[model samples]
Target chain A: MADIPIRIGIIGCADIARKVSRAIQLAPNATLSAVASRSIDKAANFAKANGFPPEAKIYGSYESLLDDPDIDAVYLPLPTSLHHKWAVLTAQKKKHLLMEKPLALNVAQFDEILKACEENGVQIMDGTMWVHHPRTYKMKEFLNDKERFGLLKSVNSCFTFFADPDFLKNDIRVKPDLDALGALGDAGWYGIRSVLWAADYEMPKTVTAMQGPVLNEAGVILACGASLYWEDGKVATFHCSFLSNLTMNLTAIGTFGTLHLTDFIIPYQEHEASYTTSSKPQFNELVTGWVPIPSEHTVTVNLPQEACMVREFASLVENIKKNGAQPDKKWPTISRKTQLVLDAVKASIEKGFEAVEIVS
Target chain B: MADIPIRIGIIGCADIARKVSRAIQLAPNATLSAVASRSIDKAANFAKANGFPPEAKIYGSYESLLDDPDIDAVYLPLPTSLHHKWAVLTAQKKKHLLMEKPLALNVAQFDEILKACEENGVQIMDGTMWVHHPRTYKMKEFLNDKERFGLLKSVNSCFTFFADPDFLKNDIRVKPDLDALGALGDAGWYGIRSVLWAADYEMPKTVTAMQGPVLNEAGVILACGASLYWEDGKVATFHCSFLSNLTMNLTAIGTFGTLHLTDFIIPYQEHEASYTTSSKPQFNELVTGWVPIPSEHTVTVNLPQEACMVREFASLVENIKKNGAQPDKKWPTISRKTQLVLDAVKASIEKGFEAVEIVS
Candidate 1:
């Protein structure tokens, strides 16, 4: 790719877009070129407050932002329900897509968005920031090391936050129409993604929702969990809720090793993140305690995870723009696999907790 | 009502009994008075190696130990299949009982042992050592604090250890006629107990075994997991295995707080244990990181948890012997509840991962 920085425009001034906007500016290869909202004042205020450069465009409508030819990519932070409509539009405009997760309401919608991106020869990636963290790459190294971690056996991940009364009633996540999947699409996306990441993006053979899911009056999920089973007997379980104290924990156990991190969705700090690893752990001779204790590994972050995400996405856009290179298939493939497993879980829940096969 | 220490006799030469023997010696109110085995050589050798006092009795047969009128209680570390026979014998002998877990082959046998205890007016307790840990009590204190932790929502616990080929082939836990429950009874006991502890011993309404449980040719489970659902929408998931690296993790999340610990079964060190807790955690303004990180709380052990267990059991025996007091119902009630949940999980697995209702 040439030295030209990727011009990144963000559609939707959702609260999350504020962080991604800063991430875009911090990304060396990406520039925050514009922001769009239904109201021009809201878009203008978001640009000024989020420190968009004076020359950065402010569009009153998403279509106006998409019409901007100079924009190399679009970061869509709209509610999940709108992902299919706006993501396809953004891709149709020949712009790369970086969209927030529960990528679409379900896999069918995600497939449509994917087809649009493919047809337009545009790159697409979900706004899953943690996977871009250096720590995640380091953990992946451990997981893939046969001598260290061995074959994966099981994994568990959880992402939950206690939603206040106002959020329960008014947040887009809890509203049936806006983000209809509710906690499953919101926090559960991270949990499912974390498990898939640990399994090296392998979709499970079966996904079965755990019994006793809590649903709100509007038929939006408040709390839920599911277990995923692989054909090789590897298993994963995840819990996500909007009715618990904030927790983000991911653990993967293998034949010879285990990987654990408490802040998996978002690290406790932006500058660095830590994970614990134990290879061939054993109990003390007396069975009173651990023999060789697990060791904590910390990775330094030069660019925060979100910034790394933007830089990676923009780098892909730059590759296509300057070198006429193809977009990396890894990101979109993983996104689809995560969505597929999530869709299976949702289906299992709808089918009264029956085991739902992952056809793909 | 005399101030005499409870005289405890050790039965069987299992490896776990070595630790429990030491615990009996350490308990201030418990005297390690006797050791017995199928052979005198093993009994004498075990007694000497485990630091039995010079005057402690050594017998060739368990019946000899049971015949000793001076022995006030028996610590039985026999395998699961032997639990019914030995536990009933100990109770029939009017000796207070502290038996290793999977208290019997099943609930029916456990009830038989309990009947013997009731008839003999003897106290009985399962050897679930972690619950006696001072760290556990401190964690309970936090859980009971409604202001800090609020209502219980969900819990997840895992306990696994990588067993060598020799263990898979020869360990009593894998033998159908011995510890028939295999990993479910061995490690899964702790996982289930941990969840029950987090839920304050409230039995779940149903138990559904997770899919892809790995079993040996003899139909013994080597690895399995289950999700438990409570009447109040509370849920818990547990995984246990003999095919993964050693990992013990217990996490309980509430509406306002969370408690997490990696070494819940046994601490990394015998002298101390730690748990992490977060109360009302929130994201920072940009949602890039947490506002306040969770805090780690550590509890020092004056006596190892096993010794604490021995001390508690011996104290109950003292009340029965000296004060003529009836046995404490709390320990038996919880043990029964844990066993009931385990039974439901086992039934769920037998019924092809169906959700089995907890009759009680």
Candidate 2:
């Protein structure tokens, strides 16, 4: 218990795998021991570049990597469309898994993966890296401190970027099987995950979606608008677009005041965040002489923490070793619910941005 | 073409009636000649309070007001639940009519109103007061000028306020017959109207909506959200609430920059609006080179434009006289389309925020 390192095997040598590889090397208890890619040349190149021990095994296929006896766990950074197949196969191998955002293309697929993991007694954690970031923790802490920011009213977010044509060509994101809600699936997921996590995983009771035309492939939504209705009457609205240029913003408004955080989708370590709150209207107006809240406050967060994906995977390993279960009991449950919401979004788009409910 | 005073009659002593009364008294070519309410006492009180002529007729009902020979036009401020009934009746009297927003609660009702007006040769305009305001005109002009603000990407608006318990107690807004989406019927319409008008009435090809719980006997909607999908691939999302404190904001993000205009629901004349746009990112590096677009050379609009609404209405009337057809081909058509969108919102809410298509 003092200091135990988990031997981690990464399956898939995509751009994200490199970040996870570094995180594994950095984490005190996580050691990246092996890596696999669809191509042997790519796997060999990645392993040699990362200086994996000579004994570390490399495979051209994910299944061969999963079969390795020395690999304790596997990180799956495969294309979103392939998340389910690999996740289930990894769980069956009894290997703990770290799956990427949009755990699957649909709710049914996510449920299937969850069931497989549960049956195989393998811990699974979604690679929603932002959720594991310290800034997110600080955000929750700030939101919960009613004395700091009053009753939460609404949250609005926008995360979009114009993609290069090369990035779109033959990308799994443009594949028909994924039902990608374009920006909603690619960048919008960050905003969705942020709000769902910040709001204590309260699944929106109702959802309405509006989408623009296909900017790339048919049914590949370029822009989408969503309205989420919460049980306590809190409302959140978000916009995701691929047709527009790069822009990211997140705003949380409460009774006492409001909070605006930019670059919420990415780590604050890489990008700076700014916030402002109204001053004239007192936070605690009931307190006769309560010092008037500052009209606005702007601060940048600078922190050195493990990469998001790496941190979550390491935490899952630690949680499994200590408690024999995932750290957050609600994460998997809410994650599947998020997938259901995404399904509704796709349905809404197909039906011309019609409202679609997340049926429990 | 000689200057002629426009004689107007009031068909209901509603809250909107008061606003219209004020606007009429302030318009140069418009004069309020009569007032009507369901109750004689209310009609008499309104007529006396607003300084109507000593002989100015006070009718006990809308029908009696329409029967008055001296009245040239009628402002129908009836509840949305009853708009169709009074609108059709008033149009049948061949009186130029200005009906309150939403036009009618449903598409069929709106069609009936328009058809009745056409048959009777009466000029009818939806009482969308904000659309006729000088500030709105200025905003449109600003958007249209490429050098000022170009290539609108998205528009988001919030029109929210807590409803007065006393007012909700007696208001027809709470009645089941209203087919009201509560906050949506009450305020969300304004947000939708703004986006639609700003985009030149390009009807959204599809729409979806989510509504919060109904809290009172009047079926008051606590909160509502809607997404509109335009044919040209533009998307707009909005939120409205009546269960919480007041907050009004409108933000339009464009390719060049963003325009943030607060308190968009109320006439800008009642509030001051300041906008900041930067081509150089002033907030952070991610937002770099977003300098504020200067407004020094932009046209300034002086409001309380004495005859803004009356003038627009008169222009419509004159256009009808000249063209021997609908004033602006877009007016009635867009009004009907807007009603259809509202109906779709209602349907989405009723169906648990399910996507509802805007059938032609």
Best by TM-score: 1
Report the C-alpha lDDT of model 2 over B1-360, residue by residue, as the tens digit: 665666789888876576667677767667888998889999999988777878788889788888887887888877788888888888888788877776877788788888898888888777766566566666776677665455667777776654567646655666667636566777777777777776667677777674564456655665676777766666777777654434556766655445555445553233233333322223233322122322322324443432467666766665565456654545677677677777787777778766687887
TM-score of each: 0.99, 0.67
Off by over 4 Å in 1: none
- Local distance difference test, candidate 1: 0.92
Cα lDDT tens digits for candidate 1, A262-301: 9987898888889999999788889898879999999988
The CA lDDT at A24 in model 1 is 92
DockQ, candidate 2, vs. native dimer: 0.10
The positional error of residue B142 in candidate 2, measured at the CA in angstroms, is: 7.2
Weakest 10 consecutive residues, lDDT, candidate 2 chain A?
A282-291
Scored against the true structure, residue A117 in model 2 reaches a CA lDDT of 86
- Per-model chain A TM: 0.98, 0.87
Candidate 1 predicts chain B with a TM-score of 0.99
